[model samples]
Target: MDNQSLNADILILEGLKVTPRSSIAAFIFLLLMYIFIMVANIGLVVLIFMERSLHQPMYLLFCNMSVNEVFGATIVVPHILRDLFVSDSERYIHYIVCVVQAFCVNLYGGVCHTILMTMTFDRYMAICNPLRYTIIMTNWMVVKLSVAAWAVVFVMVSILLSLTIRLSRCRRFIDNAHCDNASLFKLSCEDVVINHAFGLSYSVLLLGSSTGSVTLTYIKIATVCLRSKTKTINTKALQTCATHFTLYIILMFSAFIIIILHRFPHLSDHRKMVSTVGEVALPALNAVIYGLGVRYCIFWYRSDTK
Candidate 1:
């Protein structure tokens, strides 16, 4: 059995190896990052809610993204902080808790990508079909899209979690700071054919669909913008789409790469550390990106000055 294997009661999480000084530094830094992520995401959400002027489908999509970031941070950051002070067998987590944690993290990822796709659709309508934007993206329609995205992902990841719960683990040591389906399944000694198939299929289909949908929208948006004779109009159109695309890539690229890395099964420790940190850190990065780049966010910042 592996040194960190599952006993009857607990599964060891030995993913992060940090020196005592580094652990304390990491804890303080992560705690601050988590707090900033929560405050920024929640603050933006509250700002959106309070502002009647910001009640459009576009803003609502941003709100959905923010809420997902907060949800992701909540599920991920506390455990990392806990590990800083608690070590060895005390670092072990209940199997059920591990499963729940994995589900929430994946759930946030799926939903966040879905929300990005939705936002892209909103932008496409606004920029490419400006006259019909209002008529097409009604509040009722927005609510349906938002709810459907969350509901569909909940079902998808729920099935994933259900499958994970039934797996026979020969080893239970997760060598990372986070709980994920891939990490948990690494401990399995049985045939993982079905596990691999379904997991790979689900990830490929979901992420492929989400990113594909967004990319296609941007491509179409770009094509339409290029036809415009006004240089300023064309530049502005491309710039706007580029900003949204950057956020999508920033928020999910690491996870997307990590998902692909699972196929290798021989991923380096450095790569694993980068992926785990990216998973936790991306939400905070999103907040920072939008806070500085989004026009209304800038407006809010300079309101006192004006």
Candidate 2:
């Protein structure tokens, strides 16, 4: 048989099978999480955009992050919940649907990372070059960076989706609850060296670059804060970067753990748990973490009115 025919046979042999699990509880949990993430992120974005007082570069970046979080969660969590609660027959996503989900998930994931790194740079410019901060982070600059991030992620995801759909599925039953790139790739009968190589290279490049940029930004901020002449200015600088730092640490560590777990087949369940936490839980918590500073900003604004 030709490669395509062989792959088709393998796919037919595997058939559709949903692993029996107590999906009801998982479904409820995921549903609540999706609601929470959507509400919190949407609320934050509205607050940042509507409040003229919050029209600074920092809050603008936060607004963008909030929007990205909403998109990210929408791409993955709803499907996971559906797969858990809905019947197996209803859970069978078409090939095109699966590819689209994977594409959007990866696209938003990449956008999140890039925006985070940009936020770090924004904080760095604010703290280290306060006088020139306005000039450096102009509206034009923000627009350009945002466009570039989305553009790159879109192109990358499109390529990945094309490669993924080209692969003949050897198995229809994905072990995971929802359609994930890694799970789908494992079911393919065709040689996946190119897909694997592209995935690994992109992960390393994006993750490493983002983490490094955030780390360096914080380090410089710290050094600058330590040597500052005024205690109040130093404190404010630190406070401003606090949210970004928290987000950076959480996302980078979670990503690192997920990647490590992914490399070991013996730890598949562990990887799933980690993936769940990283993808679903982390996005929800990020809205909270990043919003903490915003809350303080709002409080200060209110007090000033009094």
Candidate 3:
């Protein structure tokens, strides 16, 4: 058979396995969790947009991150919930749908990494170059950075997906609950050396640059805080950096865990359970972390003024 003939119109998803009784329970739990994720992230986004006082570069970046979290979670969680009720034999997703989901999943990760990288730059300017921060990270500049970040990620994801689409598929069954670029590409019958090489390079470049930026920026930030003899300066600077750094660490940690698990076939049985933390829990924690940070900042500001 020709490679095209072997390509499947409908791909089967060997989604999470659970008994009928547990399926309902899983559905309800996920439904509640999804609801909370939506409310928390959306609430933060709305609050930032509505409040004139919170229109600074830092909060604006937080808003971008929140929106991205919502986008990523919505793409995966709701679909999983729906599939929880689907019988194993009927749990099929169209080829087009799977491809689209894979694209969106890749897009979400790219956008997220880029945004965090931008945020690090913003924080570096604010902490390391306070006087010039207003000039460097203006509202107009934030808009530009945000737009540029999204545009770059879009281009990268498009390139990645295009490469995957060109490959001839030989399989129809995806051994996971959700669609991702790696899983989609694995179906190809032909050699995937190019695909794997490009993907590995893409991930390393994107993730490496982001991690490097965070490290250098934070190091500079720390040096600045230490050199300043003023206790209040040290306190405020550490507070701000702590918030951003915490989020950065959590995000990177979750991503690394997922990557590690995916690399090892032996972990396949436990992958779904662990992957849930990276996919769902991390986003929820992001909103909580930033929200608390905002609240603390407000309180600190009020006290200082008084």
Candidate 4:
């Protein structure tokens, strides 16, 4: 047999598990969720782009997050639904395609985490040092921060992709609903030491720094709130932080689920599938919580620029 025929079996994704009876239900559920998520994310992106009043640092940071939401979901979900609803016989994704999907998921997610970090700092400045916020978080600063987020993710995930993609496949099964770096790594028969080392170190550096910075800033903001005697001041402080705080919670929880899924393989495939979905796609959930809940959105249509 030629090389093409010999390597054919190794390129397949065999871990997708949906019972034939449930495939229809799964397809329907995922389709609906994907549509809702896309619409919400797209709407947010367009709203930010159209409204000049919304062209502040905070909205720019959130615009990056919202765009990533759509990008990540598009990378993962449509394929999943296609596989579930259409590909009854051949459920295997090509290995190269899988690698690309895995890369995009991480890239989008990494950028979102960084954007949230920037957003929290913006909040800290706005609430804790309202006078300097405008001077500090200028249009150029916002653009640079946004560009920096994407640049960091691009470099790190490129390293991860380099380390993981060349490994020899021991198995084709992925054991989840979509392609993930962890899922792909587990299939490799070769030593994944480099992948594990670089992936872990990079993840810790990126997430840990963001988490610590955001936490410290929020703590400072809380102190500022406490220092103020006016009840309205405290309420406003809490309100300003509310959406970003909620975004942090949701992103962190999704990350926690990914960790649990990897650390404890004893968990059912069903659970892994759910956690997997939560990781790559949350625009619908976030739209309800952040977009609708934030007061800025209420003023999106108003001609007054703050």
lDDT of all predictions, in order shown? 0.79, 0.76, 0.85, 0.77
Please provide, for model 2 over 145-252, each residue's C-alpha lDDT reduced to its tens digit, 9 standing for 90 to 100: 778778887887777767777886657665554455676688788899998998888888899889788878888888988888998778678777877777877877
Error of 2 at 289 (Å): 1.4
RMSD to native for every prediction?
3.8, 3.8, 2.2, 2.7
Steric clashes per prediction: 2, 0, 0, 0
lDDT of 1: 0.79
Model 4 regions more than 4 Å off: 1-6, 86-89, 230-232, 279-281, 293-306
The better candidate by lDDT, 1 or 4, is 1
TM-scores across all candidates?
0.89, 0.87, 0.95, 0.89
Clashing pairs in 1: 15-175, 15-176
How many backbone collisions does model 2 have? 0
Per-residue lDDT, model 4, residue 276, is 47
Model 3: per-residue Cα lDDT over 1-306, one tens digit each: 556553467798878888999999888877887888899999998887886667789889898888898999899998899888898888888888998999988898888889988988988888788899888898899999999889998998888988999997888888788888888888888998888888888889888999999999899988998898989878878887888888888878877777788888777757876665466787888888989877877677677779
Tell me the lDDT of candidate 4.
Answer: 0.77
Of candidates 4 and 3, the better by lDDT: 3
The positional error of residue 212 in candidate 3, measured at the CA in angstroms, is 0.6
Model 4 lDDT at residue 63: 74
Off by over 4 Å in 2: 1-22, 87-90, 301-306
